[model samples]
Target chain A: MKRNSIIVVLLALVCSLSLVFLSGCATDQTVKSNTIKGDANISTMETAKSKAESVALEEDTLKEAALKAKREQERLMAEAAAFKEKDIHFDFDRYDLTSDARKILGEIASWLSKQNGWEITIQGHCDNRGTGEYNLALGERRAETAKSYLMSLGIAEGRIDTISYGEEMPLDPANNEVAWAKNRRDHFLVVSKK
Target chain B: MRKIIALLIFSVVFWCSSAACGKVYIDINSPAFQKFPLAIPEFKDLGNMKPGENLSAWFADQLSSTLKITGFFKMISQDAFLEDQSRAGITVEEIDFSNWSSIGSDFLVKGGFSYDGKNLAVEFRLFDAIEGKLITGKKYWGKSEDKKAMVLKFADETLLALTGKGGVFDTKIAFVGKEGSSSEIYTINFDGSDPVKVTTYKSLSLSPQWSQDGAKIAFTSYKAGNPDCYVIDVASGTTQKISSFRGLNLPASWSLDGKKILMVLSKDGNEDIYIKHLDSGSLQRLTNDRAIDVSPTWSTDGKKIAFVSNRSGSPQIFVMDSEGKNVRRLTFEGSYNSSPCWSPDGTKIAYEGSSNGCFQIFSVGEDGNNLMQLTFEEGGGESPSWSPDGRYLVFSSKKNDREMVCIINANGSDLRVLPDIKGVKSSHSPSWSQHLNLY
Candidate 1:
């Protein structure tokens, strides 16, 4: 019975030692979790402050930003509208310049002569006629014809680049004479400006 | 031992029972052809692989549909078949011909496939059901990924055995499709299945023409902000720019030997045709005319070239020697004629021209004597490319506010859309391929 009591005391010592080690590990985990919670609280406070500040400035910032965006949009629209207003039209299946086309191009030449440090891309278009392959070449010929006239009016050759749309993209997606006339035109777009 | 003896006795009995039935030679060229009643049962998977049934059915469906489109065979409905499965009979010694004969099938095609985890081996046999004898049998072995190619190989052989020449069923058709506001290149099989995307350059790609070997395709793409000529390998999907001149590098045609590519470059301020030596990248300018000279097509013999030129004040078809000599205009009636495609047999040229007020497909002889219009619908047809067999033409038709590819008989009788092709609602500029031995 004395030997049994001694054995029980040793078992109790081992159990107590294991409990101490386990509790030590649990304490360390608790300290780490508390540190994480503290960091989360700081972050939440910072985010709340930022959120409050943004809410306080929302009305004035939004109105000012909207007004500035509208003005910039209008400026871009006016610039694009200027180029669209002066598109040179062509007759059906013909690339030669008409008297009216020549006159409009003369006005365009004067306007181009006044501008500086700007490059224009001459997009040749076709009126949904003929094969895509043939129309492509024909459209290039049209753009070349226009570019040569511009060169004759003293516009730098480097300022003009040409491309052909070949009945793929159209100004009006209609199958009528009026739309075809509008589509068969040399559209001008400002590609680069100082 | 007992099973072997029983099998031998059964085979001998069936052989003697089905010996003599008259043979019939079908003339596919006959205007009023009685389609041969053909039955294709589901293929069997001898190895019992997981996807055996699915692959077998897929191959059988491809074969049946190809045979049906030949216009010479009446593919009997599978429901009319007495044997729902092939029953492991790939050899003449094992087949019970009476079972097929009783079902009223004139010809029968049965096949079996074995998948060994890494590779597939398919065997096909064409039998005269009435005569109870095999006409031809073939076996194809390849990687599992090449299952379609193996099936096509068998189909090609079967077609050759039936008709004196094989069909272009295994070939691909390259065309342009409108995707997300940009045009890209796409390829589809002749049977109208497996539409593969060939290009993703989100720009305008047009006029895709296949090389003579059917290995590469040359087309024009505005990828680098200029219309440049590019060649793409069909198998690897790798693209290389062939020409990037100052203006207009458009693909025109590929020579029969694939050593020369003809294109139109406007570098000289006028669109003119030039031949580029593919190996050395040397160029030979063919036309120096002030008028527009474009859309060049080479004859099958590579001795002559047919093209479109506006030398006559309007676009018309013209022919010249390979070296740009002996030029002759071919078409005079049409106000606008372009896109000339030479037939494979070197007998005729098919082109598109304005008729009345719309473009129509026309076929003219080599000497420019007979000019016959092939399409008459209000919807115009353009880009008439010939099949490898020279018996059909595939072109694009803009009818009823829809753009689709149309395949028509060379004689202009049968007009139909590609049966199972999808995403073709906005496809155009089709080019048919030759009989390629890719597999």
Candidate 2:
């Protein structure tokens, strides 16, 4: 039974390594495949971008956009929904992502691999201790670490931007170790290319 | 003859306890009292004198100045001396105290110097001519140029031994002066005389602060293309780089013990205060604020630091432990309270604040009590440095794009701008001198 457990552990590591490699290898394939749908995607994305501007946005009398508006909305919602579940969390008080964090980030790398116009921003954060001067730096470093890993997974440098907010913004308000662990993370913010 | 000798002993005893020189300082508020008058004789040169060197005269002048500045002494003229400067068989070796008692001279000052071309030394003897016993004897050593500095040191030591307070003749002032687009370091006398340019090369340097012992000065320089901290030996002119970080290196303070310097750096993408050890290049980050933290000044005991931070929507003064713990905001009366310089006595902190829509110098108690305004002009004021005696402060004010140096009393009296000497560009960042051991 111990021998079986050893084989299972090896199998799990191999699966993780393959997942990393596959996520990386799929970018070239996706880009080439994405080119076939480029013209239609641009037109549909433009229509969706305008309608998604705001609820008060006036109608531009976009004859073509009006016709494709409903399908464009569906495409964007599907695209944004695909990334909602991918949260890149980290170990307590550190910027390096955990094993579970790597798994989630691998899914993000795969999602980014399926597109060409992604301009993702990684905002690093930290649990506060010193003066405001230091936390800003810690936040930036955390964000850069995540961006670098994404780049190593075949995400182009030009498509990734990093900024540190230090301990300014937090999704969790509890002032405890668990909350700090959750706050010390790189939250992905996607800005589509012009 | 017995009556004359008794009067002479009384005068000698009076001079022994009075000023080193003729000038004296008296507060108008203090009750007026009769001063003990004294005669200053041209010191007799007992040893072979070098050409162009008057060791006796220098000693006399130094002694006179020390005594005079203290609000005592009605010093008799050097011409009234019963002797001459020429050591040509002078009667100094055969002086009698009874003669001075008859002349109504309450006290007498006399000394001499000896130089063997290879070794320069000064020997002085202070006598209570009335009691007929020597009060104090001092000897000093230095080169011709350092003779004055050494004599001042000796005088200061002797004065402290007598009065229990240090002398002020040997202290120096470290100030920042800009030339064209760049700034340089300079030092001057405590009375703001004889400005000596310390930093000749142009690299936009400012904030010249002395170590606790006044041997080394640390300031920020951009010569290496980024702001980094550098220390310069005042006597040797040797320079050493302290912090070579990637960006934003503004040295803000020195540790109370002068073992480390506190500075701001942006190597980690945020400006934070870092303490750099002088002996070892080891550094410790003290602040992690998401906002800008710059300008750190140490407390007297080295346990805590007062610094400026913009984390509270606007810049304000804050205090933290030496290890960067227990952060607390210290100012709420101003929109901006920065450039905090702690007084030597550690009772108050003089800083620049912009509460009245213009930056002005202000002082507040360390526990955040008794807010006092020190300066208020059309342009504004900043960079307050306390003198060694904690009686005076030197600061800088904005004129146009440049600044000018100004010195004021600790309680905010006698506010005046330093004279615009040649080669003075923009003047800012003043550090006052500690009392020199000038005797």
Model 2 RMSD to the real structure?
23.9
User: Scored by CA lDDT, what does every candidate get?
Assistant: 0.79, 0.67
Interface RMSD of each: 1.8, 13.0
**Which regions of candidate 2 fall more than 4 Å away from where they truly are?**
A1-194, B1-147, B154-163, B189-196, B278-280, B355-358, B376-380, B398-402, B413-422, B433-439
Supply the TM-score for candidate 1: 0.75
Please give the distance, in angstroms, between residue A131's alpha carbon in candidate 1 and its true position after superposition: 2.4
**Cα error of candidate 1 at position B218, Å:** 2.2
Docking class of 2: incorrect
What are the per-residue Cα lDDT tens digits for candidate 1 across A1-194? Answer: 99999989999988888888898889989999999999999999999999998987895688888888778656655664587677888887788888877886677677667655456788888986666788888889888898899889998988888888777677775556788899898888764375
The local lDDT score (0 to 100) that residue B206 gets in candidate 2 is 61
Candidate 1, residues B236-259, lDDT tens digits: the string is 888899999888898878887788
User: Per-residue error at B282 for model 1, in Å?
Assistant: 3.2
lDDT of 2 by residue, B1-439 (tens): 0011111011232233334542232332133543335555656665666887766666678767655543334566766655433532223345676656556555555555667775565555555556544445555554556555555554554444344454555677788776765668898776455688877777667668788777788887767755567899876889988877765566667775778898877777666888988788888999997776878888877788999887886668998888999999989986667778888888888888875456788898889998988887765777788877666678877665456788765666556677675877567678775543332
